[model samples]
Target: MSTATAEPAGRPEGAEDAQGAERAEGAEGTGPIRFGVVGTGWRSEFFARLARGLPDRLELAGVVTRSAERAARVRREWGVPAFLSVAELLAAEPEFVIPSVPWEVTPEVTGELVAAGVPVLAETPPAPDAAGLRALWEQVGASGLVQVAEQYPLMPGHAARIALVREGVIGTPTSVQVSSTHMYHAVSLIRHTLGVGFEPVTVTARAFTAPLADPLSPKGWSDDLTPKDARTTLALLDFGGGRSALYDFTDNQWWNPLRSRRMVIRGSLGEIVDETVVRMADPRTPYETPLVRRRTGLDLNLEGSEVRHITFDGRVVWRNDHTGAHFSEDDLAVVELLCRTGAWARGAAPEPYPLAQGCQDHLIALAVEESARTGEAVATGDEPWSA
Candidate 1:
């Protein structure tokens, strides 16, 4: 596409300035992790706004747009320096940079940033398709400086579920049913929940269509009763050794609120559905309990609330460091990813999500789509990054 200067006018109110955004929620005195963004698109705003709100943990060193006019707008609106190119942006000495460009051009932008020894945290898919993903990996996967911004596994509820799985709450998790996001994102969640790497897999899928009305959204929905064709695609991922996963997704499921998001993680001893769990509690007794969430700002509680943590019975499972950040689940998860990338870049944490894993997720997702379209089973384990 042409050099589209994605407007920051649509950015959420109060996220314009770090000091003024979320005073109640901004992280305090942990030292800011500096980074810049390489695009002015919707994805770029996420990082910029997050840094604006939580200056203690993140700093928006600068942002790069395609032209001087767009750069001027960025500077006037977000108060962070703006650059006409990646080279100009890096001159500000950001610890790392996040490439929030469109899918088709992400690899090019990423490669340019990498050549300057700038660490990168890339957006989803990393590249457009399997070939692009593989090519990108072959070029930078060995450098240990790039991390994909795949944060589904780190979402509070999802993270809690993963923690429970690792604790053997459901015994050995053999199957996972995820119907949240779509394509590579859903694949990433399934792989993380099932604790599988780039294993050989066989994928089979089918797409179904139906007319349905979407009722709600983050900004509420329309009262129009007109129906739209909702394509529901179901894919099965077989990870050998008695491990498999079912990925179910409906059209617009990512943003439509009428469709309730759900997951069913089944193991040998029991299973977890949403917030409740049914599993063996002891040698002779089977018990059932709910995953309770502690919130500070609802009901009769006058406190302006936020998610404090998630728990099973009384034990805390996932704690929310951004307790009052006023961020959504996805936003909260992304903030964690950014900080994790910062740590890895600074030699303080383990590799977050390697480029190969992101590629594998997309490669199998492509196979699922290919199989669904042709009504055949697609075999894996032949890719260069296959673990």
Candidate 2:
């Protein structure tokens, strides 16, 4: 293990101060929170972009990779030091460590970091299995350090849509329909928007083995399986407030390619549909209204408009001029939230998307999978799984 100390790089534009004990003592006003990242995969690049965007709030202290070649590559590409061991990386005393490694390695790697009293902003599915997830939660609890990161529900347009629903722009939300093929992704968004520990009254799932092809995968993936290509699941979730949600997952959706992953919500007064563009209903006129489709910048035209015919009310309005990736915007929102709320506050109150929320989403995902396997409705327990 090799340890080296580097001077703090000034805070990135719009960076917020840390909210930890050190900040209360007036340490945050001085510099950015040193952040050491573990893993150099695709997700790392996203975080790197975030770091670049918020240099004031976060500093790239170093990167840790298992292999010398990868470490060298990251150091050269990002212009930051790299370490081969966690201990070596920790020696620099980064206030936060982000683990973007595979789900299988999350339990072990994050467990060690939490035990060392290092806060973590880990990637999704902190563990591959329920047991691993539980163990990670336990370790985080014992360590007295915070572990939190939620990307799905916090995604840019989705978060804004959620706020709109909460504000009653869509009237009383009676039911929600989410169409997605990624089981974990859908569950995370559902759990985040509607609190955790929601029970499903009924669930019907159809599984078909299909070939999978993912160019990003190590095997260069494809979705052509021998038996079936996908599993479609429909779940009826009861939240006890006269609120219910219909969740759908289909492995094969030809139109999916045209739209960046989509989600639609229906309420008594109105409905919101998000695909390439985000469309909403006008609160006062009962007509469809168009919200800003994507993020603020990029190439999307901000002045174009489109109209769609819907069954419920009047024509749905959509805007084609919006530019930017909703996902990237969501990522920036989390960063902005972190800065505004201060970095050190524990749990969801201060963070909005806390470790507990992430854990809850994980549990719900497990229940979804379990319900699919057992062919029975799975009920969520009351335990608040936080770290």
Candidate 3:
């Protein structure tokens, strides 16, 4: 992987250098980048925090919400103006606008922003289905003002894992196993680690009801107890080059309070078993001795004993601690990169994970769903994984 050093200390918040700062300020030194946000919901809080933490790099110019009450609340909370209409938001001339609305509402709102040539950092899964995502992609491709806000791969722990993989610590990563109850979450991780290049070679799935009630279901949405409602899907993803990944997802796991999401990667040299515990067992040495351990918020260690163990604080592992909440240090590393590179803005060229990458992941997910429904092997095209 290419190595790029982060901007040194004393550099302006969003600029790479003095000249970049001048350009960012204005054509000849104007001001900071102004951001308008759409949707006032749980998701918006992440952006709110980012804006708050980096005032010079990101400024929350205004916000748009459907209800006046919610808009007023967000305005008071963030100390920024709020608008009920997209036109009102566009009039503010924000350099970028982040839409945190649901899939159903994203298309229309994104279209409005693209139509006005306003840059956008829209939330995922960009649309409800592939067609809608394609339409949004086309519009953004033509208008040059959209960047999908899929934050999963950039979330701290995952980002750290990606870095470790790139560093060859695992040695020729040949396969990965990911388990999560939510299909979307599982797919996001798969895509992040394997990239868009992974192809679904086979799928085996079974559905069963656990006879448990779902608290999140609305009154009318809970009518049926079909197996599909509580199911498990296992897929074999072939990335070619003898590399493969096994994906396991189970809705029933959600009902089990003790269950937790887990990901394991296997390679020729060693393996990373879990984010909470970093375990490396060299093939040459005994698995018991000379183990390496690195937990979150601690230094890495090379131990002489077999089966070295490292325990991370429950709060740090859960991502609920204030210091480790929402994003990790690794995640902040990527965010800092985005701020410095200005990749979050509309019309910017594609970065490591481009807009098309999201579309590809969606299509692969659709293929997985199809394979599971038909109980047959599904082969994907080369386009999905191509950068």
Best by TM-score: 1
Count of backbone clashes for each model?
3, 26, 9
Candidate ordering by TM-score (highest first): 1, 2, 3
> What TM-score would every model get versus the actual structure?
0.89, 0.71, 0.69
Write the residue-wise lDDT of candidate 1 on 46-115 in tens digits: 7889998788788999999988898888888888899987888888988778888889988998888877
Residues 1-387, model 3: lDDT tens digits: 112211111111232323223334443223455777788876676667776765655666788887999888877887778889888988887766777888788888888887876666666666777678667776664443555655555444555455555556667677778875455455666655643243444444433344444433422345444433455677877766777778777665644433466788776666767653333545445342112333343345433212112223222211211222334443354344344335334223223333455555666666677778887777766442232
User: Which residue pairs overlap in candidate 1's backbone?
Assistant: 18-52, 296-305, 297-305
Instruction: Assess the local accuracy of residue 4 in candidate 1 as a C-alpha lDDT between 0 and 100.
Output: 12
Q: Which residue pairs collide in model 3, if any?
A: 25-30, 25-31, 26-30, 196-385, 197-385, 288-306, 288-307, 289-305, 289-306
lDDT winner:
1
Preferred candidate (TM-score higher): 2 or 3 = 2
Judge candidate 1 against the unseen true structure and give its global Cα lDDT, from 0 to 1.
0.78
lDDT of each: 0.78, 0.56, 0.56
- Cα lDDT of candidate 2 equals 0.56
